[model samples]
Target: SLKGEARAGVQFVKAQMGAVSPATLLGLGVGAEGDMAERHAHHHHHHEDEDHDHDHDHDDFETFQVDLPALQDADLFLERVKQVIIDHDILRLKGFAQVGSKPMRLVIQAVGPRVDSYFDRPLADLEKGKTKLVVIGQAGLDERAIKAALQS
Candidate 1:
């Protein structure tokens, strides 16, 4: 039986696996003053689910089709993704990776513009053929720039 942190991890996996998602556990670190856990654990904080929730609440989200080069290879894809996360104030980033004979790897990362958090977990396939990434942040994160960054 799972207990303590193990139990929580299992529980989280169960809930996430049930959804059509792909991501293997990457990193999980909640800030000291941050209540990322509380917000996710309770439904009362539904607002937290949003990527952007601040005073500058002017539409702030960009989703681009994962370029062919990025999708064909995992390493290349990850490199571009990390670049985006590091270069931009990405509040949230999540995507599915499907590899033959391997469990789907879902990568969820949050760097800067808010708190730093990351989670990668293996689950069922969600993206059938194409790949996509949804990013939300403040400024310097436009679709064109993101697409260019991703293609490279």
Candidate 2:
């Protein structure tokens, strides 16, 4: 059920990427819940008025790496990636995509149970495209499901 929600959310994000606006600046920061708040405060440098304690719990993370096939559709692969991010307690993801004339670099960060929109940038400067990707999360990441999705 959670995976379904994540898939839906990612689909919305994908559509927004094209409909919203051209890619400009993209940044991703990750840590515990406490770390997230601290980082945000640090960047703003003016959240000193509110006294919040940074005693949040840290989550465990696992990692997965797979090379996509030559014919793998970038859009389809991304769809599956959303499933994995949702099904598993995935906290972070970084990868690349080369879809026809559209080339992009992706950085994904998930906080708690939330899968944030990945920042995408045009890779016009690169002479070649890369397909390999690494997914970081907890133990629930299913290698078989991911492989099956990519192969499908």
Candidate 3:
């Protein structure tokens, strides 16, 4: 039967990937969306006493957002962003910015020290001229310093 074959395939995969959590596999969306979240939460609570040792500590990750008025100079804005990335040791940064007199929104993305940006679609009728960004890094990020540096 097809159902039996599918079950066999899943069992084989699980056997090959020993110690893989059901939550991790369900995160791939193999199950219904609503049930996936419930299963994930249950698995999280259940695994607190397990012996798994993660390579990196989840408590060491931190994230923050930066929101400001539309920027006038793209060059100056990018320079400041680069400096912030270097100083803060950012792992990933991404967001959209409204640059001066431009019809389209500027999309910014950075991974490590590499930064990239491009103009996306034109601003909608209700969209305001604003810059919004989300920054992710290891714990101990100076949120105040980062916001001040970017705003200036």
Leading candidate by TM-score: 3
**Candidate 1 lDDT, 57-148, residue by residue in tens:** 23334444443321466655666667775665455665554434444544534343222322255544444444555666555567676668
Q: How far is each candidate from the true structure, as Cα RMSD in Å? A: 13.7, 11.1, 12.2
Q: Quote the lDDT for 121 in model 1.
A: 55
Off by over 4 Å in 1: 1-70, 100-105, 112-126
lDDT of each: 0.50, 0.53, 0.78
Query: What value does the lDDT take at residue 114 in candidate 1?
Result: 24
**Candidate 1, after superposition: displacement of residue 116 in Å?**
11
Looking at model 2, report the run of 10 residues with the lowest lDDT sum: 22-31
Query: 29-120 in candidate 2: lDDT tens per residue?
Result: 32355465445433343335467654322323467776663323554556666666566546666655555554555443444344444437
Model 2, residue 80: what's the lDDT? 62
How many residue pairs of model 1 clash at the backbone?
Answer: 12
Q: Give the C-alpha lDDT of model 2.
A: 0.53
What TM-score, computed on C-alpha atoms, does each candidate reach?
Answer: 0.42, 0.42, 0.63
Candidate 3 lDDT over 1-152, as tens digits, reads: 54474412133344454787776766675557657544433235444656754334566789999998888998889888988888877788999888997879889998866789998899765445889999998898999999998888
Superior by lDDT: candidate 1 or candidate 3: 3
RMSD of 3: 12.2
Query: Which model is ahead, 2 or 3, in terms of lDDT?
Result: 3
